[model samples]
Target: MIPPAFDYHAPQTLEEALSLLDEYGDDAKILSGGHSLIPMMKLRLAQPEHIVDINALTELEYIREENGVIYIGGLTREVALEESDIIHARLPLVSEVLPLIADPQVRNLATIGGNLAHGDPGNDHPAVMLALGATIVAQGPEGKRSIHINDFFEDFYMTALEPEEILTEIQIPVPPQGSGGSYKKLERKVGDYAVAGVAAQVTVDGSGACTSAGLALTNVHYIPFKVTDGEDVLVGSKLDKEAIEKAAGIASEQCDPSNDLRGSVEYKRAMVLELTRRALRDAANQARG
Candidate 1:
């Protein structure tokens, strides 16, 4: 499959890229890793007249922690996240998700910014970010602004990013002492998208009571589904069998999974229930340490 003819612009700097986006507006598409856009173009699902490639924007390829937050440059590759010590130590949920995204070749070229900005529900990062309560930074002609993960995804294949803006960074608060996170996914095969996945992050007090919790679902709804009800059920609880079962039930009930190749609607919901239980239990155990 061949993408339609388009003028390609490899910008030497972010400013040049923004200028091109401002000039072209709706007619242009920003190309980051090209993993997502290229396939869409080839299938004729996307037909932008201009391609603004930002692969040369080296300034946007980094992973660092500042103050109480971990900042991941939007252009940082999945492979980098998979190997990042900072991610492993500070953001265990993200670390867990990186390896499960796809095969090594795809991860090598898939950028975090591209993955988030693309707004695909099947993309693992959205739900993980939701569970981590991360922030997304976008740059446009007016300058930079931050969007909370809660407000980032507006609809199916849609995000809060304006057409002229480029995602620059992802900001995640450092989990406090005694905090831990995990991701549990049900996939048909190694490279397949999750049939149903859950991300769980929990902070436990000395007594092993959950002080705070975040739960989110992937590949189950029109958008990344944050299981706030499940979180509510877990917080203040010891994450006992009863609490975990209750939260799992809430997640399975609240999610709106569609029937597809993965399984029937009932099966996906069942996976959500079981995966939610495992993820929360694992996260709580990690937090207890």
Candidate 2:
């Protein structure tokens, strides 16, 4: 299948890209790494009248730390995140999960902004971003604004981004002392979307009581499911078997999986429970250490 004919514009600067978006409005689609948009275009699931290519906007391609937050450019590739020393040291969960997303070839061309902006429930970064309490920055004709991860994802293939807005960066706060995180995913095979995946981040006090916790699931709902009920279960206690089990149960209860080739609804729900438990345990252990 071939994509519909469209006008193409490669903008070298952010302002140039924004101007194109302003002109095209909803008729245009931003092309980042082209992993998601190109596929949808080819399948005719998306038929934009214009394609605004921002790959040449080098200003949006960086990874840096500022004021206790790690800022990743919208065009930053998954492979870059996987290999970033800053990410490995400050956000191990990102380094751990990047490899689990598709394969090396896909990661090489996939941008974190594209993955999140596409609003696919199967994408790995949304759940991890939720678990890390990240924020996204978007720029438009009006100006730049920030959207929290909790509010950014609205539905399947839907987000808070206006048609003319472009996501510019992702911001992740540095984890607190004694903080640790883990991502556990169950896929049909390597390089496949997760059947069920869980990302957990735990911060424990010196006495081992959880101070803050985040739990999120992927590929099991219309949006990346943030397990607030499950996170509440861990926040005031040690992540023991009983607490973990209860949290897992709560998380599993929130799942509404469809019967797909990867799994039956029941099977995916079960995997969610198991992965939640394992992720929580590993995160708790790391937090304690």
Candidate 3:
């Protein structure tokens, strides 16, 4: 499929990219890795008059740690996150599932910023970020600001980003000592989007009691959901079968499933319960260490 004709600009600096976005407004689309957007353009769902590519903007291509937060440059590729030694020790969830995203070639070209900004509920990172309590760091003509992952997705295929705004980084707080995290997804096939997925992160005390917990689900709703019962059940208690079952029930109740190629509401609902258990179990294994 051929995409519609558009003016292309590979901007070396953010300022140049922002200027182009300002000029084109809603008619302009920013290109990071081009995995998602280019495909949408080819399908004619997105018809931008101008394309501002920022792959050459080296300023926005790094992963750094400062203070208590780990800042992943918006332009950082998924492959780098999978291979990051720093992330392995700091956020093991990122290390664990980064490779599970699409395939190797796509990972090398897909950017974290693009994935988050595109706001696809089926994508892996949104729910993961929500579970990690991360923030989207963005820039606009008005200057820079941060938005919580909860508020980032406004609706289906919609985001909190303004017309002139550009996502610059994803900031996640480093977990304290004895923190463990895991992400589990069920795809029909290797490259298929998840039928349902879970991201679980927890902080444990010396006695093996959960001090804090975060749980997020994907492919169950228009936006990713943070499962309160699932998280609350683990905190202040040792994760067990009973706790997981109760939490999974709550998480399943929270989902709004629909019939699709994946399955029916009844099946997807079952997945919410089943996947939650696996995710919680995986998280518990890490917590035990």
Candidate 4:
């Protein structure tokens, strides 16, 4: 199917893009990598009267680390993140999950901003971002402001981003010295969306007790589900098998999966339990090291 006819504007500068967004308001859709919007457009699921293409705004396609935080431009591609040594060293969970997103071709063209802004529950980055306690920066006519990951995602295919705002960057604080992160996903096959997925980040003190933990689940709810109860179970503990099991159980109980081609609700919930256990264990091991 073909997308509906629309006016196209390709802006070379961030200010121009913002101006376009301000002018068009909800009638326009920002085109970053085109992976998410193109498909929706073709399917007629989205029929914007104007398409604001920001690909030429090269300033929004960078990855930099400073002030104990990593800042990734909204237009940064998945392939770039996969190859970034800075990302691997500071945020291994991102590197580990990039390959699991889609095929190599899709990853090459997909932008992290597009993936998160699409607000798809099945997208891998949201859960990882939640687990990492990331923040999103958005710019609009008013000015730039930050939104925490916990508050950014509001519902299915929805976010806190106003129609006139554009997401500019993602910020992740550097984990503490003893921190470790891991992602575990179960898909129908390679290049498929996760049937169930879990991302875990753990920080352990010198005595091997968990100082902090973050856990999130994917493809099982309208929004990425942050498992705070599960995280609470791990903190102040040595992350022994019993603690892991209890955390996993709490995560499983929090999931609200619907029956889909990936699997039945029961099966996906079970996968969440199993994957959470494995992810927590691996993250704990890395933290202990």
Candidate 5:
């Protein structure tokens, strides 16, 4: 269905966008790639009185590495992340997950900032970003501040971003030497949201022990959850099958999965255990090599 009529503004400057938000207040919606917002509006689930388009803000689209951090501009398209050499070299786990999300057509138009800020429980990045411990930078009437990815999602379709705030960048700290990361998800079809998804990053010590680790799961709660209990099981351990099984059990048992059209809570919980095991194993393998 066609979205209801709404005023549109193509603002070239961030200041203009901020002013527009102040002018329209809660009635204004920021438009990024339009991949998620347009569909919601089309279904009448979202009805913004004013749509502030930031497409013309060329300054916000970039991928660059500096000071041992990979800084991705908020407007950077998913296709850009897929093709980015710096991302591939410095952040392969994010790279792996990028193409796994949706399809090339959707990726070409989707932005990382929009994906995380949308606060969809099933979104790929929020879980992965939480695992990677990434930071989201934003601008607002008061100025700028950064938030951890884990803290960004508040509840169903809700986020920590204030109505006056605009997410501007994603910053990932460089992993330690010999670190490896990976993402895995189980979906009913290609390009669909995961029935259960996992992302993990592990760093091994020279003594063949886990030094640091991260684990996150998707589609099991109102927002992504960091599998801290599971990670604790892996870190400082050899990550054998027994260890992985226990870790998976911890995650599966801890997740607050609910019955949904995708699957019964029982089925999703079982899948979570299996997927988390696979993700943890793969991430450990990456770190070992």
Candidate 6:
């Protein structure tokens, strides 16, 4: 299928890209890695009159940790995240999830910013971000503003980013000692979108009592579902089998999924419970060590 005709601009600098966005407004689409936008355009799902390619803006490609937060550039490739020593040492949940995103070929080209900015609920990173309580940084003509992860996703294929804003960075605070995180997804094929997925991060005291917890679901709702109710159940508890079962039950009840090619609503909800329990238990075990 042929996409609608569009003017293309490859900007050498971030400022130039912003200028292009300001000029074109809603008529323009920022081309990050093109894995998401190009397919949408071919199908006529997106028909932007202008394509502002930001791939030339190399400043947006990096991964660095400072203070107590690990900052990842929006343009950083998924392969970099998968291979980064900093990511392996600092963000265990992220390390476990990156390789599961897609095959190596896709990961070599997909940008983290595009994955999130696409606002697709099936993307693995959104659920991970939700479980980690990350922050998103957006740059617009008005300069920069920070948005908490919980506030970032607004609706299906929609986000909090303004029309003229570019997502420039993702910031995640380093988890405290004795904290561990895990992500698990059920897919029919190796690179397929999750039929159901869960990400869990737990901080436990030396005595095995959970002090803090984060749980979120993927491909089970119109947006990534954060399981606050489940988190509340685990906190202050010893995270024994009984408490984990209670939290898993709450997740199964709270998630909203529809019948699809992946499975029936009932089956998806059951997988949600199963995966949530597995992720929570694995995270707790890692935290115990």
> How many residue pairs clash per model?
0, 0, 0, 0, 0, 0
TM-score of each: 0.98, 0.99, 0.96, 0.98, 0.97, 0.98
Give the Å shift of residue 258 in candidate 5.
2.4
Which run of 10 residues does model 3 get worst, by summed lDDT?
Answer: 222-231
Give the winner by lDDT: 4 or 5.
4
What is the lDDT of every predicted structure here? 0.94, 0.93, 0.88, 0.93, 0.88, 0.94
Score candidate 1 by lDDT: 0.94
Which residue pairs in model 4 clash with each other? Answer: none
lDDT measured at residue 216 in model 4 versus the true structure, 0 to 100: 98
Model 4 lowest lDDT segment of ten: 54-63
Q: Taking the tens digit of each residue's C-alpha lDDT, what string does model 5 give over 130-225?
A: 888899999988889999887888888899998888999999998888788888888889999888898888889887798888888888987888
Residue 207, candidate 4: how far off, in angstroms?
0.7
TM-score of 5: 0.97
Q: Superpose all Cα atoms of candidate 2 onto the true structure and report the RMSD in Å to 1 decimal.
A: 0.7
Q: Write the per-residue lDDT of candidate 6 for residues 1-289, one digit (tens) a residue.
A: 8888999999999899999999999999999888889989999999999999998887999999999899999999999899899999999999999989989999998999999999999999999999999999999999999999999999998999988999999999999999999999999999999999999999999888999999999999999899999999999999899989999999999999989999999999999999999999999999998
The superposed Cα distance between candidate 6 and the true structure at residue 76, in angstroms, equals 0.4
lDDT for model 4? 0.93
| Comparison by lDDT, 2 against 5, better one | 2
For candidate 3, write residues 139-235 as lDDT tens digits: 9887899999878989887899997999999999999888888888888989678899889888888888889888998888888778876788878
**lDDT of residue 4 for candidate 1:** 94
TM value for model 2: 0.99
* Candidate 1 lDDT by residue in tens digits, 24-77: 999999899898899999999999999999999989999999999999999999
Candidate 6 accuracy as lDDT: 0.94
